[model samples]
Target: MRRQPSMLYLRPFMPLIVGLSLGFTLCLVCLPLLEEGCTSEGSVDQVARLRKPNSVQETQDNPKPAKSGGKQPFRARYISTELGIREKLVVGVITSRETLDTVAVALNKTLAHYIHKLLYFTGTRNVKAPGGMYVVTHGDDRPVWEIAQTIRYINDHFHKDYDWTYLVTDNTYVQGERVTDIFDHISMNRDVYMGKRVPFRDMDGYYCKVGITEKDGTQAFSQACILPLCRGEDVCLFVCLFVTMETILDLQPDEWLGRCLHDVMGISCVGEAEGVDYHTYEFSSTTDPDNEDSQEFQKAHTVHPVVEPTDLYRLHRRFAHIELDLLYPPIQTLNPCFPAQIKNLSHKTPEGEAGLTWPIGINPPFKPQSRFDVLSWDYFTETHLYTCPDGAPKCELQGVDRQDVDDIITTSVQRLNDKYQKQGLTFEHVRLLNGYRRFDPTRGMEYELDLLVGETGPDNIRDVVTKRVKLLRPLSQVEIIPMPYVTETTRLYVILPVTVHDREQVAKFLDSYAQVVLDIHENSALTVVFIYDPLDAQNIQEEDVFGMLKSMITYYERKYPNAKIPWISIKTDVPTQLKIMDIISKKHPVDALFLLVTVTDELTIEFLNRCRMNTIAGWQAFFPIHFAQYSPELIYDTKPYPATVEFGKEFGHFDVHAFDEACFYNSDYMSTRTELQKQRKENEDVSETYNLYEMFLKHSNLHVFRAVEPDLRQRYMPRTCNPHLSEDLYHSCLVSQAEGLASKEQLAKLIFEHDNEIKSQAENVVKS
Candidate 1:
């Protein structure tokens, strides 16, 4: 004969025996009442009791229904009023050594308020924990066995009492009110299963979702267990797993329960396609705290894999805004008679301060980590790590065009002339050094203008003066008097070419440039311009480039609000070197220092200051030879990616011949380059085509200073090495792994020693 299922033992004449005993006892009492001429009300009560027991009578805690002649309407047991949903729901929390504290936090703050018949299951013996938590198990660590025993215990003790039962791991967070609301319309008679559903390994069935644990850069994707919803008796039917345990030992508990209930009892998951199973939010170590008041969080019934005890309490406080009448407190509290000590913990006290919701004995008092912290942290670390001063206000620089600051510059320059009218130092022209508009929370939009005022002497010679002023715009449409401060500062304009192919590299450079400018004192001025060819944007749409720039601008503005790092973008037919220089000359004054570079080049504050101090307007120019990195194919030849270069050797040697890639020149010298370009464009048939290095050599009248800039480095191409080269020099041809260079003192000393030799040689000749 086929073996009967283990669940069949639950119904072995127990129902029949209980029914016969209740009927016999009621009849004996009713006969005595009839002989005593019982009133019509008493007789009606006797007949009502004699009828088949109603749903209310099934649970001892639920109140009796009103007297009625017809049958009562079908009501889901989960929808309760007398004992409320708190008593109707039973939660069995599965815990282990790893999750005891987290489980305690959940029970203390959240689950204890919504579940009365709560049970804790830990299969291990001799575990020290708070009393009335550890359920006795047969010393089996398997989740399948734990789940079976929990269901069997619920069926035997709380059979037909609670309408719903939930079995979840300690890391899972249950929003009790949300679960009740989801099943408010479901009938108690129907068997229901709920959780995040995913395909079981190679099996046709689906099981509740599990999470992965990532530790020390390693990942372990373990299967977790969750059994939710369904009545006590209905869930007990899953204990039949003992009969087929051998064939299904590999299955997770949730998967095993899903298969058994579906295959044996013909019950399919009535969990709605978009219900709790779909709305659960699973968090890991790196997840942000989702807002509880949002509509998405309100719909989610549970949050899983909340392994930290403090995080569990934080989530509880978020959802604790709702005040549900706790008609039935849990049968077991973490501490005995704990409720009497506090009376009742709710959102408000009788005297009405904040919620007296602090849990006892939990370490590190709750501090709110609001969304602003996250937003600001992300802004600072968007591309690189940055440290913000303590108690700094959140601020961002709003991008503005020339027209927006034209009036501010005009007004500020006029104010300066009025202040110095008697001294005969007249301010002639106002050039925008780095004027920017910023939005202040307390005040409306205010303007900070860093204007370069051109002061003309009596001899008609011109010199630049820098004046910084802050102006307040009020609601009365009145202009406030500007406060001015003057300082002698170097002004630099950086130019670079960007394309769709170099978007990522340009983004990294932009971030690094933002950091570089942070080291600049308030007196210095910096602006950057990126030129791109509209026709050459091949890989991505032109709009994508605009979007990337827009986001990066917003991020940097928020992080370094006071630092004047202005940026501009131009679209041209071709971003040629001569064309870019011409654009700069037209927009900026002749004295504005210009440094042309590529996206792969690294920059520093010292290098920028060197360009400013070394390059004299019209008298001298700086042509820095940059250090280049090695080729990946040469160093990691035939090896896999991330291969290391030769030990103790950094990549690349300084190329003394490379001067065209990075150059610092004034607009007067740029005019000569423009003339060369114009001549080339006109005379195409010329045999001798002069390149940039040749142009530098031809302009011998200007003292063109050349030196190796140790701080500046550039990337090398793939074929930078040759196989015929000696093996001793092979290390220089491999990809660079240089995170940092030699100390600043060391590099500065090396550059000074080399530069003095060149300076002495240049003095002997008419150098350019």
Candidate 2:
């Protein structure tokens, strides 16, 4: 019927036939290599894999290991110890109906791998939960009560099969590897209830305390004193339980579980302790905005309320990268065909340590490598804290004596009372109620104290009435620590020097700024300053440009009423921007920062923080190297060009060093202008070519040159906005004819060889 099945019919299955033949040939090739009497218990999987090369294989327990093998796709298997943990532990993600989809995404991204017995529970009925999660029939509206019922269900069912149960919310991100290690030390038989323990207060303002007692009802632990309640009622479900709608209604799902467990299982809520310390809570997502760098985030067993799907992915990606690096360290080259050779294998016996294998010549076969070694407790348990360097100026009162602080507070209160009496003020609460310090190095100190003094009645000591008084101290001997003023929260100011060519350019600029403002407003206290001349716009009306700018600002202000969106617009020449900067820096708070960027530049929150940290008052500045794009004419041209294009490909010549657009500096770094003026007079030849970046580097005490990856790609501005030229034609003419004239690699190599010479030349210029 098909003329004996022609070559065309077999062409579709050619890849499959070739793949099978190759796999079979490799197995045949490998089988003869193993010498006689070389077989051992550890070699079974390897032999099996060779015999049936095309067989579908599942990892013994951890089926889907979260190992990122980029070019090498072979995953290291889980060890016996890690597999045992997977069999014993069960994780339940407690979620509400509204956040189920978000929770599912989080679980799949982070915890789905390695955790064998993963389950999720919600309160909505008749709704299909993804990944075979559980759903309850009732109590969907009351999420708090639903959580209580969920716990009871877990304890009833899971305690028999699973040794430990960890319940977290949909938004919580649990570091599974860290959690398992913590559970290894904890005993399932013991009374264990662990979370971030929050002190609970009743409707009547009485604190709830948990008292330990013997089985016979005698108190075994000291009890915290309870405050008196306004309406005394019998709300005790236990020995001391205060329940009210005003109080219990606001209890979060975690708090509700803690209370429910105390009543049902008779165990108190506990936190970090000896041999078991893993739980830490953060109520918000902590992700680095620019690079999604996990190193910047606080190290904890769990980070909670990572509500955004994107944030969950960020945390997962970074954490997975960390694990992958630990497993296959970058120092060692990995082989795709063979198992990784692990040097520090955990299961080595003393005999094996003495270079003895089970068989005569072969080394003991590799079992699936364990990610965490036996002595890796320190890696998981050690806490990382930020500390100021010794001999550095610290903001806190670190070395000062405690008694001296007490004496100062007491003396300041007395002086305030004396002033209050003279002023005939009825504010009698002049005693030291509370006090805090904020430091300004320029001014000595300003201590803001809350003083309380009362007029006692003759009848009873308890009848004494008090009034609150706020005082600032400049009293005879006591010095004050000045705090930041309310209006001085903004630390960085961005200055934009713009030239508008057309309505299209203006629109693009506004759109870019709007996105930047949205990204930064929540996290940063900063302002934007626009420096441009109205007459510079050759295509659009100056008035229309101003109106557009105003509209953008107004829209943001109305949408985010609480956030202060400060935009300062100045119509001036480009050189005048520096003078405005000098004026602003002189008046702004100490260590206030400034940045220079074009209107087209997009900024990230991470870069802004980097700007703040790198720039120190009168000391250092950041002059970031930028990527200069190649000519658009060569890019869009159908004909061959002089140099090869490297824009999107690996090792491709896309960007080159020409101009730097971004500079970050603090108030004290304004010596740039002064130094430039001196240089111009001293050596007129070099002054004309000496740029702002070079001047900043020469004047500042310390200068850091960092390359901005995914750099600020400035839009091309034509020499003239000619009415005859079309938009596309104008773009092509913007790039100079000399550009794309030579290979980028040659230029890069030349620069690299002469880097030292260039530095020496700069130094010589400074000396002159």
Please give the lDDT score at residue 368 for candidate 2: 35
lDDT of 2 at 733: 30
Which regions of candidate 2 deviate over 4 angstroms?
1-86, 131-139, 202-242, 263-266, 279-286, 289-298, 325-768
Q: Please list all clashing residue pairs in model 1, or write none if there are none.
A: 704-768
- Per-residue error at 446 for model 1, in Å? 35
Model 1 scores worst on lDDT over the 10 consecutive residues at: 215-224
Candidate 1, residue 404: how far the Cα is off, in Å: 41
- What TM-score does model 1 achieve against the real structure? 0.29
Please report, in order, the local distance difference test score of every candidate based on alpha carbons: 0.55, 0.49
Count residue pairs with overlapping backbones in model 1: 1
The digit string of per-residue lDDT tens for model 1 on 1-768 reads 334565576578878989999999999989976865534454466576789566544567765655534444466655653344334466777776555645554554567656666677667776656533544444666766666676667655665456666666777777767666655554555555555566656556655554543110000011111233233324444454455756555556666666655554544333363333336766666655534455666556677777677677667656663332132234333565774556454324564424343333222223347855322211221122122233354333233333345556666777787668767778965566554454443334466666777997666678988888766543332334322222225666776655445566766676667667654443444455655566544534645455666577667767777764566666664344454555566776766767777777777777777777767665567778777665544434375644222222345556554443544456655766755556665755211233344565564455677888777776543223333333423333332223223334545666897799898888877563
**Over the stretch 509-553, how does candidate 2's per-residue lDDT look in tens digits?**
555655665544534444555555646444245454556665766
- Judge candidate 1 at residue 570 and give its lDDT: 67
Which candidate number has the best lDDT? Answer: 1
